[model samples]
Target chain A: MTTTRTPKPATAPKLDPKSRGQGWGHYPLFALAFVGLALFVLPLLGLVVRAPLTKLGALFTTPALLEALRLSLVVSLAAVTLSLILGLPCAWVLARYRFPGRGLVRALLTLPMVLPPVVAGVALLATFGRRGLFGPAIEWLGVDLAFSTTGAVLAATFVAAPFLILSCEAALENVDPRLEAAAATLGASRLRILWTVTLPTIRPSLLAGLSLCWARALGEFGATITFAGNFQGRTQTMPLAVYETLQSDHDGALLLSLILLAVSLTILIALRGELRR
Target chain B: MTLRADLHLTLGEFTLDLAFSAPEGEVLAVVGQNGAGKSTVLAAIAGLIPLQRGEIVLDGHLLERVATGIRLPPQARRVGVLFQGLALFEHLSALDNVAYGLRARGLDKRSARARAHTWLERFGIDELAQRRPRELSGGQAQRVALARALICEPQALLLDEPLVALDAQTRLEVREVLRETLGAFAGVSLLVTHELDDAVALADHLLVLDAGKLAQEGSPEQVIRAPATAHLRAMLSARRTGSTPDPGT
Candidate 1:
């Protein structure tokens, strides 16, 4: 009763082993690949290979360290929540609709992700800085964004939202709109279709995106520093804290980096489990 | 339960101008070659595709003239479509998929699940309610789709080749279930297909579309005996491949 017949023929693209006179080119490329993978992986292995086993106790007990870690979690989690609330719809628009300036909007969103994090910091400072366009109006309301915890969240969100937006959009794009159409024919309105049919179908992508956005926000440093000036226990997140520790407490900095990496990896694995078919 | 449509639409390289009616409880099979506008007719009627001119009336409601146009969105139309792929949500269980329409209509989760269970039971797929689309056999998927669509109690059902994806062995069984389901439907049904066997199995009225135009519309025996056009005669030939004069040429 199984459908064992008519297996699909896969077209695997390959180069013939016997025909090459490109040994010189092949060797360099092979060597480079070996070096590249090692370069990519060696540092991560080095973290475990060279840990300050004895000083780990002090690193965890520091009040400043705990506060920074707490701030990092709060800001990054908020950033991810906001990203889902906002970016999911934005992703839908980018994925499903065609309009003028769509390509431009997509590219600009990538700016925070691709540009040097420090340069993104400068960009954010210019836009939301005290003397920036919205700064005067913002200050007049007795609300100070610069050098504040909210500033860290805003800064993280600026860079992190793009990750969720792109990932969720791609997931939404892959969902067959036919299913949504099918739902519509069943007496549902557009909004109803989105909430009930469309959202469930694209849930994995949204989850994946938020996880990535949270990871990105957690690792955010330059934008947080520039937009919200690092102040320990106030705006200094784990990354900012790590930067401060780098000068005087190298072991502590490494410990914080390791924790961040471990947490992000766990999140990614959990997210993948959620998204799997 | 009756459905009426007068539609004209232009999509990229093709145009569709169709006027048709399916009385309550009748199953109308739309037979056409590729790009013959059969799918376009369904999309237009479902309000998925924009129409340059036309209106659709479903069970006495002027569906085409609302602010959104006689083309109320696919959701508001309450017309069920068994898309060619069956397009089940890959992530959801069969029960959840069947409950999709009820939820979209804003039913409470409890009521939706109950209705979905009723639908699955009717389709005889209740045992497979927890299975995802990928886990179901082709016939099972089709049944799930049918159940999902029927649960809404749509005024009309539009099926786009419900059996095309099935292997030969499975298609016969699925076709039989589809036959029974169509017979049981209290509303109008329209099945779009290129296969004569499929059209004949579930539909009483047949439409032959050639190049975005309706070449002929009648019962299957009538079409088989006296095809309206030579192109249609060639199409009617059992072989999947055959040549016909281009309608434009």
Candidate 2:
């Protein structure tokens, strides 16, 4: 029996990446994407274009601006540190363990991320204000968390911690359980494995979370004003200062907004690289 | 010294019940199709998974006794495992990966690194010590993982499909390295593989498993000459045909 094979093509058709999705179908998508991009870009451009550049020297010398910048840095750093200390265990448990209501617990922890900043301030006030839930106990300890710098820090932490928790939980979930098992077989304890294996493995994402948390804390205004009550050097951070100065000194407010915009843009760019890793 | 395990584990719809013993300095290779619970057996012995019932005794020390509710954690088991993926610490340098167990045991960084360097030399990859796991070739990474596993001097070593990640040529090279390195080790070793060549070449005893139960058990030659179950016969014929069976579950 003789078998004859059909003649094959002399050359296979190579896929040209440039030709991919290059049709009328992509126009609407491109148009919508550019529209969305413009929505975000326009306001930022407006901030830069409308700025009084001639007063830049004077803007840099404002005592209120300097004070607000210092408070914003200190408060955001403290909030991120607190989030790392408290949210890491929560994130680990959410990622590595299975139990009833685990999903509910995760959802509740993430709720703060979506919650309005003002509402978060209200929530904080309900829990820690002088006439609130833990008011008596807190007073007994000789501490006042309301209308103070600590209150601004608490408000920032309340709204910003969920970012760290969610990022860490995602990173933790992606970690291979087998690596931890291998570490265990090498006689490394749980704490040792977490220190030498888990954290290092998730360092990039952890840093991303920390930066996101810091950025959120730095931009906190509604929560800080509602809970901590703008007290200049004590409780008024950059965002709060921007809001206050906007009602009076418009130029100073734009300068403060630019400082915040610069910092947030830097954080977002850094976070993008971290997330890419 | 001997390592003995009688494990009965039930995970979801699958159940595993097996008992095996290997004297010190011997390699027992478990060959099975995917989902035969071969890896499950290793996990149970290594204390990564708990057995519903059964006791594991290594060198006359009870590692697990479900009846008495006494179970040692994996850290206390002193059972080294080279996972299927090799599970090398990707963030660490090859030297740091090998030194991890020593550092965990409270050795200072300088001493731990010095000892790890010696292990890297034993594996003939001392020059690659500063390179991360991702920078190494498949066979080179396998050497690093092997060095990391043995650096702690475990009482028993468990290897899960150690060669599955390698290409054909790399597999042969790694298999040769495993043969020479495992020869010098004094611990009872359990090698889990689906390849009959690996089982015959590296194992002192071969245990054929099918559907979470032991299908046959004997020396490599004995098992090959007399395939006890259909699974074993199929594996033998596949080997004869020079076709690799699917290793994925």
Candidate 3:
């Protein structure tokens, strides 16, 4: 036999009329949102529809394509690693310190994010290239950056590191400094507090920044080509290879573009919640 | 077991210039209006902020001396501060939050967590040790923060509006906990609060701060019997009449 029980009384208040979802006003808003979303979806659909699916296996087997894939992975990963190493301290300083020209310094640091990729490449070359500003100092250290794999990494980092730095700086700024102060009063040193409290508190934003930096570096084309001079098995990343193949082999270019698109879509899907926040 | 501070500093348009001493094993409640530099005194004693020209001595050790240019970092000052926001590390479990200071001082995780478990038990929150700060109720979080602060056995303890975030019932419960804790602790305890009731209830000595300076200091009964400044008079009058004090007055 089943036992009967009384339903609990509703304690929660009713929702306000204005906040109820899907009113007449939503139609126009959704229409515009759909149009904006279609702008992104249509191009991706075109890439998939025009991809060389019949020659997909053959494309995968191609040594040049594989080498470009490997190089892309290497360069982008290096750039991301370098970005984390340099950007974290830069972000902390920018967020915590107050000195003269702080706003200007922040603007200069994040300028690369909005600056044209080719201009960034040119700027990097002017600063690190032979006969450039730091050329003598770099040469004396027996390191050549231009037209090498390292130059490709540097170019990608120069354009992409700002993404990591900007997100992290905003995250660091939002963290209550009182938490760090509390940690200090608990006998934790500055470095210990950073590792334990500060970094853990900003972990989500740090991951988001890492993914953005890696994706930007992976898709970097103009900067790498301008500064590093794309060469097979040397500095030719996937985007550079795709660009060169488009001039001669359209199907090969489509396949390479498909690969990059797939990787970017995966990143966006994985970081959907974090990116939304 | 005494904290003597000569806080002399300027921030923007306001300046904090005061000298106060908190005796061991007793609560000294710092009562003030908003922007009266109540929290500044705690910050200076905790070594979180520098003093332009002052000295802070805790347990006869020089925490800060501007004349000699000797300023110990907060990590070395052996001062525990429970911030107004209760700044518990949200990323860690309650047990880990309580265990933070021990781990910071090089205790092994097992030992620190074991001791933290004991503290949680003492605070009657052993069951909620695995929960995060956000998951716990305000009162539970307060206990966790108190446990964290006291675990290090510091020379001084600072509580900045620790019960201001709690409801009336929870405030009374936590105030009882705080009274018991302060009675047991052998260090100097400075509580910055806005409520006269809490000050009179939990504190042995009452300090009235007005506009970044000390307005009065006496026992709670003494201060209650003789209100010093206009702010104090207004506060006591409001309490007697069961009304809120007027902000303009």
Number of the predicted model whose lDDT against the real structure is largest? 3
lDDT order, best first, reads 3, 2, 1
Clashing pairs in 3: none
Per-residue lDDT value at A110 in model 1: 68
Off by over 4 Å in 2: A1-25, B243-249
Model 3: per-residue Cα lDDT over B60-144, one tens digit each: 9999999999999999988889899799999999999999999999999999999999999999999999998888877788889
The sequence of per-residue lDDT tens digits that candidate 3 reaches over residues A90-203 is: 999999999999999999989988899999888888999987899899999999899899999999999999999999999999999899998999989889999999999898
Q: What is the lDDT of residue A64 in candidate 3?
A: 98
The models' CA-based lDDT, in order, is 0.82, 0.89, 0.89
Residue A134: error of model 3 in Å?
A: 3.7
User: For model 1, how does the per-residue alpha-carbon lDDT over A1-277 read when each residue is reduced to its tens digit?
Assistant: 3552233456897788877755676888888989999998999998865667688788779899899989998999989888878887788889999999999988987677888877777776777779887888888888888789888888899899999989878888887878777767777777767877778877877777777788899999888898898899889999888888889977777888888878977997777787674
Q: Report the Cα lDDT for candidate 3.
A: 0.89
Q: Which docking band does candidate 2 fall into?
A: acceptable
Runs of candidate 3 exceeding 4 Å displacement: A1-33, B243-249
**Candidates' TM-scores?**
0.89, 0.93, 0.92
Predicted candidate 2 versus true structure: per-residue lDDT over A146-251, tens digit per residue: 9999999889988899999999999999999889988998888888889989999999989989988998999888888988999999999998889999999898
- Index of the highest-DockQ prediction: 1
